[model samples]
Target: MAKIVIREELKPKRVIALMSGTSCDSIDAGLCDVFPDLSCKLISGINYEYPEHIKSKIFQIFSGDATIKDICQINFAIGQCFSDACKVLISEFGKPDFISSHGQTIYHYPFDERIDNISLKSTLQIGESAVIAENTGCDVISNFREADIAAGGQGAPLVCFADEKWFHNKNIAIQNIGGMSNVTVVSDSCETFGFDTGPGNVLIDYCMQKFFNKPYDRDGKIGFSGKICDSFLDCLMQDEYYYKNPPKTTGREYFTKQYIENALKFAPQNPEDIIATLTALTAKTIASAYERFVYPNVGINEVVVGGGGAYNPFLMKLLRTYIPKHIELKKHEDYGISSNFKEVMAFAVLGYCTYYNIPNNLPSCTGAKHRVVLGKITKHV
Candidate 1:
């Protein structure tokens, strides 16, 4: 392990942010320079796909009923993967002041009751930061969820920090369509609000893999080629998950294989129609959530999209139909932030914030009782 001191001449600072998303497909790494206060500049980013076996194992614990020991072992292995990705990032982009790794979340269930003083609510993110620090010789800040939990917050949509720093405007809906979809209401006063809207690419990917033998409907081609089943769409729209208010968060746990099975019971016999229906389900649910909760309150003028879902033209088109003429629907790329790499950029910023002892979680978004500094530090000592 190596410890590197910050040069006095560097005013703000720099860090590499790494995130392995819910999809378990790969690791996203981004290098960024940040001002001491909170400004950010993206330097470089790349995605590294996991080996097939590791991918399978990740899906196993995440989707399966793995025990505690199973999870602990996987955490260390995932950490090594994180460290390897950091190595690749530093080799190309050079060193940064610190590293923030979002690690990989295997399960997220925010709703739980209390036993004694502690709430049973919990979320799990694998990938040990210490391994990352030891292997990369860079200080690492990670486990961004604990502080939010301590504050009684949901510990989600941490990307809102990136939204505030890079995309904030008086009248924009910063929509990030990741494995899940979340939107941030950005206004001039810094009083921002965001939450996981619903399923983003997660359901789409699940449907495509189960039926079409594909990872995802690339560019939403299959969805474009298929016709929507109105009945299926209607049934999906009625799901209680859609009606839940803000401060809510969900994951593969809620939208499980069981839920899909139930939805499929009424789906059209044709798998293509089912795919179209699921894609429509995602787009409509997202748009509906925005129109219902965000538009009236914030009076949105722009919808800045990010995450892998931004690549789906069909989803984008569907989103446009629900928004207003006064509002703009576009990708983060249009705002100089690559949609695919934005989350990576966020984790980098979070790492820098954590290292400087800056508080990063927003109480409004996570419903936590108060603001708290997020993450644990791992030293290369």
Candidate 2:
């Protein structure tokens, strides 16, 4: 057996944080050592892409109208994936003290309005944490969003607490572009507000899968080689969702195949041109959001880009053109944290907080009533 040393403070406490992102790409597993009082040190992080067949089933089931039984079954099935991924990590790095799984967010509707006294506000993150805990022989914390929503918040942009703790600077906007693009403005005053800007890779990914038969546009090769279509850009910009005020959140639900089809209907364009315009759409929306909310409020001197979109050169170039030349543009990796792993590592940190009864949600980011400790715990026997 390989030699292993557990910190005296964390003698029997380890945590695994798992996430299946909106991109529908893979399962990201991060393992860490967390002490009794919520201090965490990441040990390892890895990703497990779903087999194509399984991925197809999940996408099909989650994308549109589906029977309630299918939804219930897939929840357990997603948990099994998390459990399997954790098992692999345990075999490679050792069992954990606990697990924090973000699960797969199938639906999240965070708004409630009423002319009378009736309103509906709910969010669902599927994947059975109890099942994962049972399978892994470790305590688990999952479904980390409901509490924030109940407090009258957007119940999203959850990555801000991690951003504040790990990457916040005096005058920088931390922009994370995953399936959706979101920005967190951190000022010298220490005030922060983060909301999803718009679709990140979701639109681009949809276009690629339709036109090229690939999951993603590999390093944006296709977009780089294409020209923007003005008509499509005009059509897509018409979405009222794009112009909505802050405290808003969206998902694959908003930027779906149907949405793309509608945009394409007004102005039919070639596939390559469509990709370019979509790529520009992400860049422009991100830049515009920062200019409006972040720069005006905090006066940004630098923009720190992160997440999967940080790797897209075409997107980066467009961002440069859109933002002021005086501001520096860079990736989060320059700060010693890998952009791709930051969110996965964040859940690990949250797991530590939940274990120690520390609050993880930032009220400024989520617009919650107050800073409340998030996540529901399922303990190991």
- Local distance difference test, each candidate: 0.81, 0.81
lDDT of 1 by residue, 314-333 (tens): 88887887666677888888
lDDT of 2 by residue, 19-65 (tens): 98888788988887655544456678888887677687678865786
Error of 1 at 81 (Å): 0.7
Candidate 2 Cα misplacement greater than 4 A, ranges: 1-13, 34-41, 114-116
User: After aligning candidate 1 to the native by TM-score, how far in Å is the CA of 127 from where it should be?
Assistant: 0.2
- Cα lDDT over the full model 1: 0.81
Model 1 weakest lDDT span, ten residues long: 1-10
* Lowest-sum lDDT 10-residue window in model 2: 1-10
Q: What RMSD value applies to candidate 1?
A: 3.7
TM-scores for all candidates: the values are 0.94, 0.92
Q: What does the lDDT read for residue 130 in candidate 2? A: 83
Number of clashes in every candidate structure? 3, 1
